[model samples]
Target: MLGAELREARRRAGMKVGALLEVLGFSARWLSKLESGHRQTDARNVARLLGAYHVDSETFKRVMDLCRDVDGGYLIQGHGVGGADEVSAVRRHEAAARQLFSYEAVGVPALVQSEDYMRELFGRSVHLSADEVERCVAARKARQKVLNVGVPVKRTFVVRELTLRHLSGDREVAWGQLMHLFWLGNTRKVDVRVVGQDASFGYWDLYSFTLMRSPQFRPVVHIGATPYSLLFDEPRDTGFYEESARLLLANAMGVEESRAFIAHLAEHVGESVSA
Candidate 1:
């Protein structure tokens, strides 16, 4: 990100890379590698580039802040995009992002999942012990408190109609989870949308994804919900997922309709909430 900014700063100044490299006393290959993100860079190099670009103090400070902010929070978005940035732990995201847009191709988004759903879902995982399941459920509930009123982080969740009917073996568990979604969907902090089965969205083929936007750092996209998920931070890639989220919102049912959809499905799928 530092390198991309530097390269852009130079171009915005109408300075050629060859000329800037000469001023910096560097080789073309070296500068090229840095701008392309193939090589790592440090504060000293960033300072020199910003100075040469003669960027305004605010731009300079913002870019520098991005470098510092990203130092410890992220991992390289590798070829396969695994490792959790925020999707893995729902709480970390409220601090990291100003807004979150999530799409799940199948089951409920993790943030809104009910305790019973989590227990049943986690119990299916052989890798997690019984103790691990309890710990995770407790932590998830605590983290989800941030989803309530007055939190600054904006949240949007788009899911398939299939998720409404999606059943766990336990009717009680499924009922609890869908009711939780109904309640959560009505929250001021959350905007929920459901894509009807009849709707055709090309990206529907995708398993699941989350896009995060923050004033402090670049946008990020976490693809898939499983342990093996991909995180994309590069502007080009994150931009694509961001656009995908927009399209999803355009096609999915409106917020009120979505709440009704989930409510109707929940009413039909299992015993009533009163039961």
Candidate 2:
């Protein structure tokens, strides 16, 4: 996490790694190792780099905090989250994640949600002001950049059948969402599944969670929380979400079956939409 942050900060500052090596009197391999997470970095090194980068206070604090994390904690606890602020943190991980797994029991995952469906979903939330809702939707759209075909991120999305069946209790909206999900399932590097009666998911109540893994940073588990969500980078916390993700996969319909099922559901419900 520290290494990744350093690289991001350097790029933001438009500083070439070669230039930094000469100024910092560090070898190329050593700087590469530090920025690649191959070797843990110290505060002194980080301070010097940030000083050269001329980073702002927030980036300075964030980077220095990551430096102090001898235990290598990258947890972002957003107790007082603004609409876009917390999502930006998660989006940073999503932007760099090599792989992503999202399980949504209540509604569609943000990464794959259609624009209309997302706006409608957010419209129902009383807690979010209009501007806040707009910012949240915009942030999700930004994060969805990872879904671009050229991006290397592989994504898996598992959603509940019931949630698809009656989303916002609007057949047209639900049909569009189902069609979108089915289309994404057939796309490259994307897998969409539906949790149906194929297995015992009756007791499942978890709303939404996503796990992101990157070779350059520790894995993170994001759980839904008030105002926003909390990110856990510890092995113990990530391990539990990993297990839950496995269970979700075990309970969800096969990719082909889910695709076919969603297609059928969309055709059945899209009559009015098409009409």
Best by lDDT: 2
lDDT of the candidates, in the order given: 0.70, 0.77
lDDT of 2 by residue, 111-218 (tens): 889878988877778887898778767766766777884768778999888887877747777887888888888766789988885468643436578899988667
Instruction: Report clash pairs, candidate 2.
Output: none
> Where in model 2 is the C-alpha error above 4 Å?
11-45, 56-58, 61-74, 77-86, 202-207, 272-275
Residue pairs clashing in model 1 are 81-229, 81-230
The sequence of per-residue lDDT tens digits that candidate 1 reaches over residues 94-141 is 445679988877787777778899778767877777887777677666
TM-score of every model? 0.66, 0.80
Residue 74's lDDT within candidate 2 is 47
Candidate 1 contains a number of clashing pairs equal to 2
- Those runs of model 1 whose alpha carbons end farther than 4 Å from true positions after fitting are 1-40, 43-91, 224-229, 270-275
